[model samples]
Target: MHGSSSRIVGGDLASVMTREGDKVSLICQTDGKPDPTLTWTKENRNLSNPKQGRKHTHLLTLVREEDAGEYRCRAENPHGSANKTFRLVVQSTPNHMGTMVPLLVGLFLLKVFFCFLLILATFWFSNRQKKAPVMREDTTRG
Candidate 1:
């Protein structure tokens, strides 16, 4: 679905679609008497046009997790300027690290078991020393 007369004199327009965890492709279409200046913008920030001299369609690919947001395409000609907005949703796949939580917990428990064994050994040695017999010589009856 396209919106109403977002058209201008120079004929610069941009459209794009994006999905999460996938690449985003921006297509810019220009049709003017001479040629129009084509540019891209996201959240009002200006974007450099990769296709400088070409009057045909241009495609820009962005592959990044952080590149998920609203993107605006501005086509400017001598007559006027038109803009179209696109919402990009970048979905992140389930990470393998998330699946390792249980494994990590098991390893931690193993470590705790080893520590407990060390503590038990120390306590056993201390108790054994305390139980040893102590001898004193009898000086008067010898």
Candidate 2:
């Protein structure tokens, strides 16, 4: 008797963010004693098969707000069936990371600048300590 099992590969089963007019594909790979058949569904409705293979990728094109919802991928074999769920989130604005790139770069540059300053200071202090002190006459002599 074969048992049906499925697994999500290359991606976590969490909310995926995408913008409008973007292409999105949800990936699912299954392993079973008997090769499991993969099917894609959204909101309990069957979705048109996209890329077909042991690893199924449900292709979503030109995504809109209405296209965002719970997606399920089921792998069924002779024995039993297993499924996994993923969420799609459509954002009106650009990716949050896009706005943060400049900030991150500035912070990185600041860190590099501080590091350079620290190295220069260490070198300067070490070189100063190596130099001998100048001899001075005893001014307190009677």
**C-alpha local distance difference test of each model:** 0.60, 0.79
- Each model's total of backbone clashes: 6, 0
lDDT of 2 at 138: 97
User: Which candidate should be chosen as best, given TM-score against the real structure?
Assistant: 2
**Native RMSD of candidate 1 (Å):** 8.2
Deviation from native of the Cα of residue 8 in model 2, angstroms = 5.1
Report lDDT (Cα) of residue 66, candidate 1: 73
Worst 10 residues of 2 by lDDT: 2-11
Cα lDDT tens digits for candidate 1, 1-142:
3223224333333334454446556555555433556677777776665333223332445446677667766655556556556666665667888889989999999999999999999999999999999888889996
lDDT of 2: 0.79
Quick one: best lDDT, which candidate? Answer: 2
> Lowest-scoring 10 consecutive residues by lDDT in candidate 1?
2-11
Task: Compose the digit string of candidate 2's lDDT tens values, residues 51-116.
Answer: 334787778899988989999888776666677888999877567899899999999999999999
- Angstrom error of the Cα, residue 109, model 1: value is 2.6
Model 1 stretches with alpha carbons more than 4 Å out? 1-21, 49-62, 107-142
TM-score of each: 0.54, 0.55
